[model samples]
Target: MLDQAWFSKVGFDWHPHRGFETVTLVVEGQLEHHDNAGGHGVLDPGDLQWVTAGSGVIHAELAYRRRPVQTLQLWVNLPRRKKMSQPRYQNLRAASAPLVEGPGSRVRIFAGDINGVHGPAELHHPVTVAHAHYEEGGSFTHEIPGDHNGFLYVVSGSVLVGPDRMPVENGHTAWFPPGEPGLTGIEVHATQATQLVFYSGLPIREPAFAYGPFVMNDRSGVAKAIEDYQSGKFGPIPTTHR
Candidate 1:
């Protein structure tokens, strides 16, 4: 996950990429996307875009206006079989994602299933991602998968996790290691008005070689990626992609 941790920030000029996936989750104001893959759009709060730069692609993200633009661009590694698949994209808007409310809290599911409900994202891997909002003193409990790697990130508030109600400060990513660990469902309490994002996924226990935007399984794969990129395997960014 990559972020400037600011609601409003500037971005670099357009760039090219390959060998991985980018999931941009907009949490604040607005963001604009332009890419060589014939993609362009403005993302408001709660909007997310998934870009699969399989074989190759070029893309850029920038501020859409003077609005706050806090967004998390997460790169999920691709396995060998999906490393060369055709690039694709899917945008899941805020309204379309499932919203579950409890007392003074609201939880929006972006991917994976919870309470037999699924979010509107399609991806090569199995994972669950969700954003949560809580009023002061609000509390919510969630049933996590038995064997999934799960954790919670405190976006901007104090929170307590697990039965012990471990205190988590802002800007902290509280990781929950796998196994019973005496934790089954997690109960989160907001010491103040708070917001958080939860994640759970099947662990991809493989070696990874990474450079810039490319993430491969080994050194040779990284070298080949560099070669393909220099040789223009990824197309150019169109002037009108924005």
Candidate 2:
């Protein structure tokens, strides 16, 4: 899962930070980071780094020469009220997240609730993010809130979703349709080996626009973000940061 966030395939580079929230989940290995606000440090596996690039922030992920690393980064969107707020960060260790285990499956939840176990993360919207591993022939099913959107990303192996039993493989993502207005949830079955990340969030359905690293609710907002970054509103990364 190294750099699995959005699967950009750009092995973290040195660039001005983006105008959004970045939640990084380290599955293996570690990372040293440098941010424009004079923030620099190393993150170990099972660690989560939540950075709000609010108005703007510049940062980069440095290579950890120790061993290979696996990670997943998810971008969280802020509402109009918070888009221009001060940038901030939240660093959470794995111990803070809850790992629930059953006879044939295990789940580590970072947000929302899973089988009565609550996660450690807090968000602006109601969302759930979890990593699940199921042994062969293991299956799991849960009802999603009717108002939220849900999807699953296969990290390893394969799984069949829905009544049609569609097969989703590694590196592939399957977005589930919104639950029925009166239904509570859906079911997922694993006929073979399987591991996946399931995420569900309340739909915002707001207009979204993006320009490079700048993400805004509208084109005018994007323009403001660009102007602010160029005018030094986001601050500066130390020249020694490489």
Candidate 3:
């Protein structure tokens, strides 16, 4: 889910996980993430912190300022073969990402190519992420690969997608199914401007078992994870939750 936390401080302390990939993108303010696996850092605007909880790990995220925090956290499905692999993390900074600009639009590539530039966020699966900003009455077209499930989230102003002229307003999301077409057109209508974050990924064919920050293949795995954490298998509790 897309989360908008306004000056919110959460102590959802670290825990263990066996399978899945969590991608957290910071859109505004700052956040600090620490874990027992020797990974700790802070995220600023346009930064992406991805943790692949393959085998298991303990982690935490805390707000570090009084200003509101806006970010997107996505849970990606992992294939069965990679479910038990070793844990990994990627911290991508804003300078590492690529940006494309035109007459009335700006595009930031997070995982795929726009025109010819590509983002620096490494991926275990095929995906594309882009943040687009358009001036009033501006328009652009994004080419979607065949058989790829894609969606566009309007973060500000209003945008029209596809020939049906589907109206996507601020805080609304629009999805494009596979095998439909190769390109999706977007038009912004507002006195000021418009913005959207686009995300597309390969569809997984495996079952998903999710329980509050932990995602596994089945209920048994989830139960085992909970037991392991309670037994202190991950690590000792941190002195500060933040």
Candidate 4:
């Protein structure tokens, strides 16, 4: 969560990345992104940006305004098979998400299918990502694929998770235990007006060597990525933002 008012004064400069993808969600204010691959976008609240640095790429992110901005950024590893594929980007606007509304709650499916509603972005990995908001006393149930690992993060307020009603407070995260080989229904009951993000993904079950912006399967891969980056193989530094 990038929320401090002082954060507006700081910004990420040009950097290199390889062997992974970045998923960024703007929760408040705005974010501007740019990459050497010619991809650029300005993300407003509820918008998402997905960048796949398949082989390599250089990019930067900066606050779009001089105000408090809250953003969530995730690094999704690419399988070894697709580590050196082609680089790509997806700028998913907020309205592209499919909205699901219940009694006192609503959800925006941003990166995967939910109850037949599909998200706008396509990726190499299988994952379900959603942002949801609930009024006090609101409740909802969703099914998760058993083979995927899942977690619920309370962005604000409080909520009870699962049949056990495990309490998850603001700024905290709750992990769901591994389940059987099928879909499992999970319930959420908001104890107060709350907001949260749900993320579930199929595990890679492979070794990972991470150093700064690079994520590879082994040390040799990381070294090679570093060498290539130093050799100007990750493309030139991106200087502009949209």
Tens digits of per-residue lDDT for model 3, 1-242: 45544446653456666688777777778877888866778889778777888877778876755455677777776777777778888897767778777657777787865455677876777777887888987766776565677788877788777776777888889887766545444333333488778877777778888887567878998888788778887677677644
Cα lDDT of candidate 3 equals 0.73
Pairwise lDDT winner, candidates 2 and 3: 3
TM-scores vs. true structure, each candidate: 0.91, 0.85, 0.86, 0.93
**Predicted model with the maximum lDDT:** 4
lDDT of 4 at 213: 83
**Model 1: per-residue lDDT, tens digit, 36-107?**
756688888878888888888778787776456787777777777788889888888989999987778899
lDDT of 2 at 224: 81
Q: Decide which is better by TM-score, 1 or 3.
A: 1
Candidates ranked by TM-score, best first? 4, 1, 3, 2
Q: How many backbone clashes does candidate 3 have?
A: 0
**Model 1 spans > 4 angstroms off:** 2-9, 66-68, 180-184, 239-242
Give the best candidate by TM-score: 4
- Superposition error at 42 for model 3 (Å): 1.9
Show where candidate 3 strays beyond 4 Å. Answer: 1-4, 114-116, 180-192
What are the clashing pairs of model 1? Answer: 7-69
Error of 2 at 128 (Å): 1.1
State how far residue 173 of model 2 sits from its true place (Å).
1.3
Candidate lDDT scores, in order, read 0.77, 0.72, 0.73, 0.82
